[model samples]
Target: MGQPIFYGSVHVLFYRNDEVLLLKRKNTGFMDGMWSVVAGRIDGAEEVVSAAIREAREEAGVDIDPSGIDVVGVMHRKNTSSEWIDFYLKVKSWKGDIVNKEPHKCEELRWFPLGDLPETVIPYVKSALARNHDRIWFESFGW
Candidate 1:
């Protein structure tokens, strides 16, 4: 036996009023054209919450305080090649104007009503958000 290998990612949801920020994925072969929140793979030796803050800034050009982030849910998923552990975080506050910092990787950034997200949202992302946070501490997909 060997050590288990799982790729970890962090996602942050930025909300204003009744809307949540989402980005249209592009050029990323995994889920091109799908809507997703600000997210990225965790870098080496970085904490999950820190990764969430970093991703929010990197993807949306916003600065988020650590104290304003809340861990909402986690999803453990598997594709044909590998496993993933995705941490979902909700941001209570942030600074700076939100913009698409990575135009090449993202097509556009927009805000959508939390209750009526776009039909093209990534399946797991939609599933995670639709469920009550307290009811879904962890989720598994493509087992």
Candidate 2:
């Protein structure tokens, strides 16, 4: 038997009033032209929550409180070539204006009503958002 291999990623959902921030993916080979939230893979020697805070700052130019981040959902997603353990965190408080810190990997940063998101959002992200609201703890995709 071979060792099980799965990648871990953190998705930070920043909400302001009734809106949620989304980054338009660009240049990134994985999900080019799709809309996603502030997210990235967990680095070595880093806790999942710490990864969330780092991604929020690196990708969106904001500082999130570690205590303010709540794991709203976790999704086990698998495709033909890869699998991911996605940590969906909701953060209501943060410092600094949200800007596109990684413009090379993203097109624009925009806020949308949480009730209605763009049709071009990555499918799994859309599902994750709904799951978070429904209080569902875990979900599987492309199994």
Worst 10 residues of 1 by lDDT: 127-136
Instruction: Tell me the spans in candidate 2 whose CA falls farther than 4 Å from its real position.
Output: 1-3, 133-136
TM-score of 1: 0.92
Instruction: Name the best candidate (by TM-score).
Output: 2
Error of 1 at 79 (Å): 1.3
Q: Go through the candidates in order and give the C-alpha RMSD of each one to the true structure.
A: 1.8, 1.6
lDDT of 2: 0.88
Task: In model 1, state the lDDT of residue 42.
Answer: 98
* Candidate 1 clashes between residue pairs 3 or more apart in a chain or in different chains: none
Candidate 2 residue lDDT tens string, 1-143: 85768999999988888888899999878889999999999998999889999999899888988887788888999967888999999885888998889989999999999898999999999888776453538899888
**lDDT (C-alpha, whole model) for all candidates:** 0.88, 0.88
